[model samples]
Target: MEFSSWPQVPMINQKNYYTEFLKRDDQILALRLQQDERLNARKKAAVDIDRARAQAAQEGLPFLEPDPDLDEDEAMNDDDIDNYGSKTIVINVGSQNMRLGLATDALPKTVPMVIAKKAARSEAEDSEPRPKRVKLDEDAPSEEWFGEDFAREYNAMAQDFRTSRRGNKRRVLPNSRELVIKWNSTTPPERIPEHSDPLRIDWTELPANPAKAPDYIVGSAALRLPEKSKPRYQLYWPLRHGWLNEKEYDNRNMLERDFFLILEESIKNELGLTHKKDWNQYSCVFIVPDLYEKAFVTKVLDELIRDFGFQRVCFIQESLAATFGAGYGAACIIDMGAQKTSISCVEDGMVIEESRVNLKYGGYDVTETFAKMMLFDRLNYADFNLMRRHDFLLAEELKEGFTTMSDENITVQTYDFHLRASGQETRKYTFKIYDEGMLAPLGYFRPTIFDHSKKLIGRHKLIPRSVDLYNGHPNDPLSPAQLAVIAYVNQTIPSAVMPAPAKPARLMPTPMVSTPSKQRLLGLPAHLNGDKDATPLSSPAASPPAEDAGTPHPTGEDANGDEVGDLKGAQPDTEVMDRTVPIMPLEQAILTSIHHGSGADERRRREFMGSIMLIGGASKTPNLGPYLEMRLRAAVPQYPKEILVASPPRELDPAMLVWKGGSVFGKLRMTNDSWIGALEYDRLGARILNYKCLWHW
Candidate 1:
C-alpha cells in the first residue's frame, strides 16, 4: 500500500522545449530579470519599515511623523470599530446561491438571493447546434457508438466546445417556444396547429420564453412541459466561527425576515391565506459542523431551544452523519470533506471515538497541491508569457474526477488556452491515465507501523525491550534488536522444552478398618486390620456405607448368600469399582497446571488479553466477532458452552451513540430526590461529582 513512485504528467516533453526556449531567448530573459528586480525592491521596502521603527525606538521618539498631506481629522479616527448588536443574523451561503434566514424566529424561512454579476458573450460566436432528428433513409449507415473509441470522441468534442470562444454563445431558435393547448384525446393530431396557421394560432397559449431567451419563438406545439416546482423554505446558517461581519450579519437578518414575509405573501398569492392552512407553522433543524468541545454543542443546542423554541434537538457527529448517509455499517469512514479529512470506525451502531483520526489533508489541500504542480509544470513548458493565460476553471473538477482508484481506464480532457484571440485557438488535449502507482500525498504515517514491528518480533510481544539475562557487563549484552528477537523466541518456546508429562493430582488412599463387630455388621472380610480401619458406626463415610450390624462374619458370604465386601468399596462379584476412580475437580486442575507452567506463560496470556482490547478500532472490523470467538474457545478449551454476542439496539446511529446515550440520560424521568437542575449546577460549581451530590434537576 506504499506510494513509492512519483506522479507522472504527459506534457513534460513540451514543457522541456519551452524551458529551453526561455533560456535561449533574450527578450524573455530580460523581462524575467526586470520582474525579479521589482520583487527585490518590494522586499527591500518591507524591510525598511521595521528598520525605521527600530531606529525611532532607539532614539526614544515617535515611530512615524504625521503626513502633512493627510487631513488631521481623518488621521485621528483611522481605526475601524466593530459595532455589536443584540439582534444579529447569519446567512447560509451555498455553491449555487446564498440563503438568508432569521436566527431568533421559531419557524425561520430561508430565501434564495443571488449576488448578480453580469457576464457578456459575443453575439457573433456560434452555439452548439441543437440535436435534431434528421429524416434519413431506413438503410442509412448505422454506426453503433460504443466502448472506449466512442467515449473518447464524445468527450473530445465536448471538451473542445467547452473551451472554444463559440462555447459561450447564447441563442434563441424559432422552435424554442412551447405551447399548451386545451385539447381532448378526441382532437386529431393535424388539428394541433403547426407553423402554418398564423391567424388561428393562440399566441398566449405558447409557453413563456426560455430561461436564456426572451424575444424569439422557437416552435409552436400543443404539448407543454410541466412547470417546475418552486424551491421550499429551509433554515441554514454558516458553521465557521465569526464568518459574518456586523453589517453583513445585520443585512442577512433583515433578508431572513423579508424571506419569511415573502413566503407568507406567496402562500396568499398562490394558495390564499386561510385559517385552516398550516403554512405558518414550520420547524427547522440545523446540521451544525463538528466542534471539538462538548460545551460548544451544548451552547448551540441551548440557543436553538431557548431562542428558536425548538422542541427536539438532536446532534450528530459529522463523520457519523456521513457514514449513516452512505449506509455503511462497518466501514472506515474516510471523509475527505471541507477543512479536514476525518476517518472513523463505525461498527454495530456505535462509533469508537478513540479510533477516530483527523488529518488536515482534504479536498482543499488536494486542489491547492494540483494547482501548484500545474503551475510548476507550466513553467517548464512555456515562457512567462503564457503563465496565468488560462483560467483553470475545471481544476477542482478534474482533480476530483481523475483522483479515483478503479480498474477501468480514465480519459482526462484538458485545454491550453490562448490569452490573445489571434495567438492560438484553445488546443484540445486528451490524457489517458491510470490511477495505479499515482502518488497521493496521504498524510505522513505508515498503514501498518505497529503491525510491522510486531512481525519483526515474533509471537506478538507487547514489550520486547533488551536486557542482560545474567546481569553481565554492558559489553557482554546483546543489542536491543537481537535481544527483542531472543525474548520473542523464549516466549514462543514449546512445552517440549521441559519434556515432562502433565501429572494428575495424587489422591490419599482411604485406610481399611475392621473389627469383629464392624466387620460382621458391614459384611467385610475378617482380614481387615482393627486399629487401622475400624471406625464407629455413627462416623460419616466418604462412600455409601454397606448395611451390616455388630457380628463377626467370614469373607465367603452374607446371611442371604450375597458375597462379602471386597477391598476399596468393591463387591467381590464386580471389578468395575476397583478399576474406576474419580479424578480431581476441573477448577483445581486448571489452577494447579497453570501455576506449574513457566512464569512467562502467565505473563504472555495477560499481555495478549491487554492487546486484544487495545486494538479498539480493529474490533469493529468485519469477521472480527467470529475470529475473537474462535480465539476465546482455543484459550479456554475446557469450556464448551456456546458464546453469545448481544446485538446493539436498532435506530441507534453508531456515530451519535454517545450523544444519544447522554440525551436519553438527560431526558429520563427523574424524581425530586434524584433530579439536577441549572440552579444545582451553579451551586455545586461544576465539581459536585467530587462530593457525590446526586441532586435532581
Candidate 2:
C-alpha cells in the first residue's frame, strides 16, 4: 500500500517475475486444497451421522435430526453407527456368470448363470426317442435377399481361393515361419483354474438331500449331470447377450422363475443366508448392462426389493463399475463375456450415453468353433454334441485351456485333456492343433468365422453387407447400417426393378447382405414370405428395348413376364429387409462407440483413448488386451499415433471387476442416500430405481 514503502522493489526481471507469479499461484492452490481437505473431513463425519439416522429410521428405531448447533460427530448414537450399512452386499450379474459377496470381502463367489429343471417326458416322445428337427417349407421361395446373387458370387470367390491354395496345405513353417520344433520345446500351455471345475462337479460334491431331490439344480453342477440322465433335466441359461434370454426360453413365466432362482440360490448359499428373511438385513448393489431394456431393469428392481427382501438396492452400469474398480477417471471399457462383448466410453464416473455398443459374440462362440475344428481333425472324443450341457461344458473347458491370441502367428502342438463327467469314469483324449487353436479365438478379429456354417470357409447365404456404424444416432436401437438399408428399400420401392442375373446393375445404394450376427439380433421373424402371390406391379410384357439400359430405372419381368421388381402388391418381406442390415464386428464396434463420444466434449474420445480397459470373463485370455489395441490402432489412422489398452491388475480378476467396483462404491459415504430403501419402494415401486441409480436408466 505504501508502494513498497521506503524499500525499493528489487530489479524486476521478466523471467523472475513469471516464476514468482507461479510460486504465488501454487501457494494459493495449496492453501485452498488444505482448506478443502479440512472441510471434507467434517463433511464425512456429518455424512456418517446422516446415514446412521437414515438406517435407524429404516430399521424402525428412534432417531433425531442433527442439531446444527452441536458438533456433527457428537450427534450420532454409538449403536446406530455400528449398525449403519454394515451388511451391504454387492452382486454383479452377467449373461454366463455372476459374482456376489459382501462389500467388505476381498473376493466374491463366482457362479454360472444357469439352471437345470426336471423336464416332463411327453407321452408321444417318450416311447419313440428322436432328435427334434425343424421342418422346412415344401417349396422354399427363391427371392433376391441381396442386391446381387450372393450365393453365386460367394461360391465363385471361394472356388478361386480354393484353387489357388490347392495342394499346399502340408508344408512346414507354413503360416508365419513358426516351426513345430520351436513350439514343442516350450512348456505346455497353462489351464485356467475354472476349466477343470466347470466340466466336472464330482458326484460327491453334490449330495442328495433327504427331503427328496429338488426339481432343479443350478450353476456348474447343472453342466455335470450324467449323460444318460440328461434327458430328464433341461439346462437353461437365464441370461444371454447380457439380458434375460427371452427368445431362448419363450415361456416368460418359466424364464422368470429360472432367472430369479439362479440368482437367489447363489446369493443365499454363498453369503451364509440359511433363511429367506435374512435378505432383510442386507442391501444389494447390482451391475446391469450398458444397453438395457427399461422394462427389464424395472422388473429386476421390483424383484430385488419386493420378492428378494433386500433392505435397499442400487444399479450401476457395468462399464462404469469397471472404471471405479480399476481406479481410472476415464476409460473405454470392453466387457467380453460368454455371449456378448459390450463396449462403452466412461468418463468421470459416468458412461457416455452415446458410446454404448453391444456385439453378440464371445468366448462361447470360440468354444463351439474349437469343438468343430478339433472334431474335423478327428479328436478322440467322437460323440461331442454342443447342444448337450455336459458336452458344451467340455468344449468350453478345452477352449479355455488350449486357445490363445497372438499377433505374430500360431504353432503346431499336441495337447491332451481328461474328460470327466458326473457319475462316470474319467477318459483321456489327445488332439493335435495347428492353426485351429489360434484361428478359433481370432474370430474376434475375423468376423466371417461366425457364420451359420461355423466352418469359417463360407457364409450360410453367402451374403456380405457393408456396414457403416458411426453415421447414425447412438440412442436409436437400430444400427446405422440397418437404418440405411431401410431408407434404401423405401426409396426404391416405387421403382425397384430387378436386372437380369447375367448382367447385374444396382439402381439402389451399395449392394449388401444382412450381417450374420445382427441379422439374428435385428432381423425380422422367419415367418415373412417374399414369394407372396400378389399381382405384379404392372401388366406382363416382353423384355424392354436396348434404349432402356441408360434409363434412370428399368422394369423387371415377373414369372409371367410382367414389369415388376418392387412387388408392391406383396407386403414387404421383413426377412429380406433383415438381410440388408449391416454387420457389426469387434473392431468396427469399438470404433463406432468412440466416434459417438466426440460431440461436445472432445475429451470423451481422447481421455478414453489411452485407457481402453478390458474386463469381463472372456477378457482373461492372454494377450487379448494388447491384441485388441494393435488391431484398433492399425484400423484407425485418424487416432493419435499412440493408443494403449489396459487390463485389471494381476491381483484383481477381470471377472470380478463389476463386483469390486460396486464394493468400493458401497463403502463411499457420499452414496449413503442413493440406495432405494423399502419405504420408498413401497410407495414408488420399481420407479424408485430411476431416482436412486448412479447413472441414467
Candidate 3:
C-alpha cells in the first residue's frame, strides 16, 4: 500500500498508464499558460497602448482619444460606490508591511506597519552579560567524557553501516551526526537553548513605557526619524507574529485601537484619504490568515464597519486568496511571512483546516540568525546589536542581499556592502562568507538555528486556534450536542459534583493566568480538599446558550467557570503544561498537510505537490523556488513523480499576488453574497461570519 519506490515493471513505465500521465501533464501546462495570459490582460493592454502611442509620435500624428459611446454617469464615483466593484479596496496587512489599493489597480501601495508617538523621556537601557559559568552537576559527565576510547569504538562499529547512509560530512551534509568526539570537546546536545543574550540595545535611550503616547508618524516615516530626535518619539511595531503585539498594549481594547490607528494613519498617508467619513465610499477586502482566531476576526469586523464606516466588507483566507492569484486549483500553500511560516493544503478554493501548521519563526528570525552568524565570523558592524533599530534594519537588508540557496558550490569570495542608515553617514563593510549565507537560510529546516524556537517551547503565549474554541471558553457558545454530553456526565458521573474545572491551557485567551476561582486538579488529597477547589466545566445548565445571542460578558472572564466574585485560592491550570514546543520542520509539515488534505487519494496528493506555489515576502529569496522543490524531492525519494514548484508569471509580483487575487475575487458576482453589510453585522454580531465564510470554519 505504501510507495517506497516507483513502479518497477518496464511495462508500467512505458504503457498506456504512462501515456495518460504525459497527456495529463501537457493539459495541466496548457491550462496554466491560459490562466497566466488571462491574468495579464491589463498588462498586455497597457503595453499595446504604449506601443501605439510611440508609433503615433514617430509618425507625427496627434494622439487621438477614441469616443466609444461612453456615458459619464456610468463612471465610478464616490456617491455610488456600492454600484461598482472597481472602487473596492483590497488590504493585506502583515506584521512588517501593509498593502492597500483599489481592486482595479495593477499594484497596491506597500508601507511599513509601524507608528511613532510622542512620549516622555525615559532612562536608557544598557546591555550586560549573564553571570559567570557555574560548575557542572554532580551526576553530569566531565568535559572530557567523550575521550579516545569512545571514538575508537564508535569508528570501528560504524564500518558495517550502509555506504549511502554513512554521511561523514557536517558543513556539507547538515543532517549528519558526525562530531569531533575528542578528549576535550563534546558531542552536541540533541536540543539547546535557542536564544542567546538579546539584552543589548543602543537605542534604549528613547522614551517608551507609555503605550497610549500620541502617535503621529506612520509607516516608512516612522523608521525615518533622526537618531537624535528619536529620544522624543516611541516607535512601535503594532503587529507581531501574525497577531496584535501584547508587549506594547496588553489590554484587548488598546490592542484593537492600536491596530485601527495604524491602518487609519497608513491609509491617510498612502492613499491621501483625509477623513474617516471617506471610508464609507470604499469597500474593504481583508486577506486574513487561514488559521485565524474567531475573536480576532470579530474584533476586526467591528473596527472595519462599526468604527471606520466602511459600507460593506468581506474576508478571504490568505491560502484561498493565494490560490485565486496563483491560478491553481490546488496547492500545498507555504506562506513564509516575516515573523512566521505557515503551511496548509488548499484544495480548489478551500483550506484544509486539520492540516494547517504555523512555525513561529520566519524571515525576521532568519535575518536575526544571519546577523548572529555573521558577527561570529567578523561581520564589520561596530558593537552590532539587533536591539539597535538601525543594525537590525541593516541586517535585514544584508540578509536579502547576500543570502542564496543555490546548490552550485560557491567559491569563498570577499564582498563589500554599504549600510546607509537614516540621518547617519553610510558605513561600508567588507566581509567574506564560506557557507554561512546558505547556512543561515537552512534554519528554516534546522529550526534550532532560530533562537526563538527553544524559548517559545511552552503554553506561555500560546493562543487558541479556531478548532480549540468553544471547548469551554465562557464567551464561546456551545452546541446542543455538547450540552447533551455535559448533561449526561452530570446525571451519571459522581466526579461531576465538584466545582467547575479550569479551562484548558490551549483555550486561554492570553498568556498563562489564574482564574477567578483558584481551581486546580491537584487538590490536596481529593478527600481533604472540598468542592471549593474545583477548576472548570461544572454543570449542563451552567453552560452558555448554544447560539451566541449577542449577550454581554463581564470585563474579565471566569476561566474557572465559577462565580465572578469568588477570588479564593485560584491557582493557574495545574494539568501539566505542554513542554513539547518546537513545531514540525518545514518539510515535514508540508508533507503531513499534503497527506491529510488528499486523504488516501494519492492522485490528489500528487497534484498538490506538483504545484507547490510559493508566496509571501520571504518567498522571494533568490533561488528559493528551485531549492524548495529539491528539498521536497529529497524528503520523499520513494516518489519518482516530478515535483514542479510553480511561481508567479512575469506579470505578477509574489508580494502583491494575494491582494491581486482579492481584487479579482471582489469583482466576482458570487462574492456579493459573501459581503457583510453594516446593518447585518449589527444584528448578528460576530457570529455572522460563521454563515458568511465560504468554507467550513
Candidate 4:
C-alpha cells in the first residue's frame, strides 16, 4: 500500500504502531527460541552432575559436600548492582531530536559532532560538464548479479532481510556464494576500499547501490578530552509538539493541553524513566507563560506528584529562563511569537519584574488581519462564500510571500464571476488581484499616532474631543479604533520600555535640590552635571560626585530652611511618584509572553555576559538578540558606555541556557545549601518555616 497517498492515516501513529508491534513480536519469538535452547543445556548439565554424584556414592566413600556458601560468594564476585532509585539519566529532548544517556559522565569528547554541508558545485562546471554512463560488459546477462556487485547488493539485501524478518516469519535467500567487490571506472585509474582487510562478501543481491564516495571529508579537527573535568551533572529535556495535532484547533486552552500531553510523552520516551517512578527522583522545574496560572501549574504538579510520584517541582519564570539561556548581560528581551510579542529586562541573571511587558499583536494576529483585508478587498466583485472557499489557499500564499516589513508588490491570481447578456450558463472569469498599499506587518511594533475623531460629544470618558477632528476626513491616516487596538496590543508587548517620568521638568530640580543633601549624606557629586559623574539616582548614596561646588545651595536658601514654592515643590518630585505606580496584574501575562519569544538582541546579550542567561523557547527566535541590544541602547542612554551585552557561542542551545545554568547550580560546592529536598521538607514539616528565619539570622 502507498501509505503516503492515504492522508487519513497519521504518519506518526502508523509508523509507531507497526514498528512497535513488529519489535514486540520479534522479541517474543527470539526469547522463546533462546529459552528452549537454554533449558536443553541446563538439563544436559544436570544429568552430568547427577552421574558424578552417583559414581561417588557407589564407590562407598561419602561424597564431600561442596561449600554451602559457594553460591553466595559467586554472586558477590559478580558486577555490583546499583539501586534503580539512585540512577540518573540525562535526556536532552529537542524540537526535532532526542538524546538519552547516563548522567554520571560528561558527553564523550571523542564523539564526532559534524554538521554535514552540501558539496558546492561551481555554476560554470555544472553548465559545462555532462557525465555519460559507461556500459560494462554489454553482453553480460542483465538479470545476473556480478561478484563486484555482491558487496553492495548484499549490504542492501541484509537491510531488507532485517526489516522483513521483524515479525514471526523469516525467509532465506537462494544464493550463498562469497564474492569480492571493488569500485571501478572506465578510465585507467581504479578505486578500492582503503582498509587492508577486505570486507566479508555476501550472496544476496541488493535492491540498490550506494552513492559514490566524496573526494574529501569535511569536519573539525579532533581534540583530546580534558583530564580534570567535572561530572555531567545537568540533565536537559526538550519537548516538541507536532503542528498536525493542533492545526485545526484555534482554541488556546486546547492547544496548551495538547502541548502538555506531547511534553509528557516526550519526557517518558526520551528519559527511559516514567513520570510515575522518576518524577520524584529529581527536582522538576517548569518555565511556562503566565497565561498558565499558578493554580494550574500547582494542580499539574500535584497530580504528577501524587499519581506519578513527583516530589518536588519548581516553577521558573520564563523571561528569567530566557535571560539565563540567552546570557543577555543587562538588556531587554523582545520575543515575537505566534500569539504575542513580549519584552523583558534582564540584569545579571535576574529579570526586572517591573520592566517586563507583552503586546497582543503577533504573527497570528498579523495573519488574521491580512486574511480580513483580503476578504474585504475581494468583496467588491466576488460572493463571500466563494472567497471563503479559497481562503486557505490565500492564507498559505500570504504566509509564504509575507516579509516582516517588505515593500514589495504581491499579486495573486484568483477567480471572479461575470454574467453575459444572453447568459444561458454562468461564465468563469479569471482576475489578478494587486495588493495596493499593503505594507509589511512590521509597523505593528511601532508607536501608533492616530487622529481621534468620530465622538458623540462626551459620549465616552476616555475618548478625547480632539479625536473629532478626523471624523469626516476619508483620507485620514489614523483610525482611533485602530489606535485603541494598538494600545490593547501594546499591553501585551513586554514592557522593556521603563515608564518615563510623568514630567521631566519635575525631575530637573530633583538632582539640584537632592544633590547637596546627597553629597552630605550619601557623598554624591558636588557638581550636578559633570563628565565623570554617574547618574546619582542609580548609585548608592555614598559615592562622591566627581565635581565640587563653591557652596552647597546655589539658590541661596539656607541648608536647614525649607524653600517653599521654588525648587522645593515646583516639580512634585515625580521621580518618587514612580513608586506609587500600581502593579498591573496583566504585567505577569506579558512577562510570560517575552519568556517564550525570541530575537537576535537577546542572543548577543546572553553570549557576551555569562552572568545573565536567556531561558525559555521565546528567547530562541532569530534576530531576537540583536533587536534587544538596539532597543536597550536606545532605552537606557545613561549607561551607554558602561553597558555590556554578553555574546554566547552560536552553536550553544539558547533555549536551554537557564536550565543548564540551573543544573550547574545544583552541582555547585557552596557552603550554604540553596535547594530544599523533598525528603527534608517532609520530615521537618512546619519546622521548615524556621529554616528561613535561621538563614536570615
Candidate 4 regions off by >4 Å? 1-263, 269-275, 278-282, 288-293, 373-401, 406-440, 443-677, 680-697
**C-alpha positional error of residue 364 in candidate 4 after TM-score superposition, expressed in Å:** 2.6
Instruction: Evaluate residue 531 in candidate 3 and report its C-alpha lDDT on the 0 to 100 scale.
Output: 44
State the lDDT at 290 in candidate 3: 70
Name the candidate, 2 or 3, with the larger lDDT value: 2
- Expressed as tens digits, the lDDT of each residue in 485-508 for candidate 4 is 222222332232234436542212
| lDDT of each residue in 84-114, candidate 3, tens digit only | 6665878998888888877777789998887
Clashes of each: 23, 2, 9, 60
Model 2 residue 604 CA deviation (Å) reads 4.1
Candidate 2's displacement at residue 64, Å, is: 23
Q: Quote the lDDT for 600 in model 1.
A: 25
TM-score of 4: 0.34
Q: Model 3: which residue pairs collide?
A: 500-535, 500-536, 501-535, 501-536, 502-535, 502-536, 518-569, 518-570, 518-571
lDDT of all predictions, in order shown? 0.27, 0.58, 0.57, 0.32
TM-score of 3: 0.63
lDDT of 2: 0.58
- Please, what are the lDDT tens digits per residue for candidate 2 over residues 270-382? 87886988789888887778766665677788899889999878887888888888888878888888877888888777887656766667877778666655543444454
lDDT of 1 by residue, 394-451 (tens): 4444455444322122223233322211123322232222211111111111111001
Model 1: residue 221 alpha-carbon error in angstroms: 34
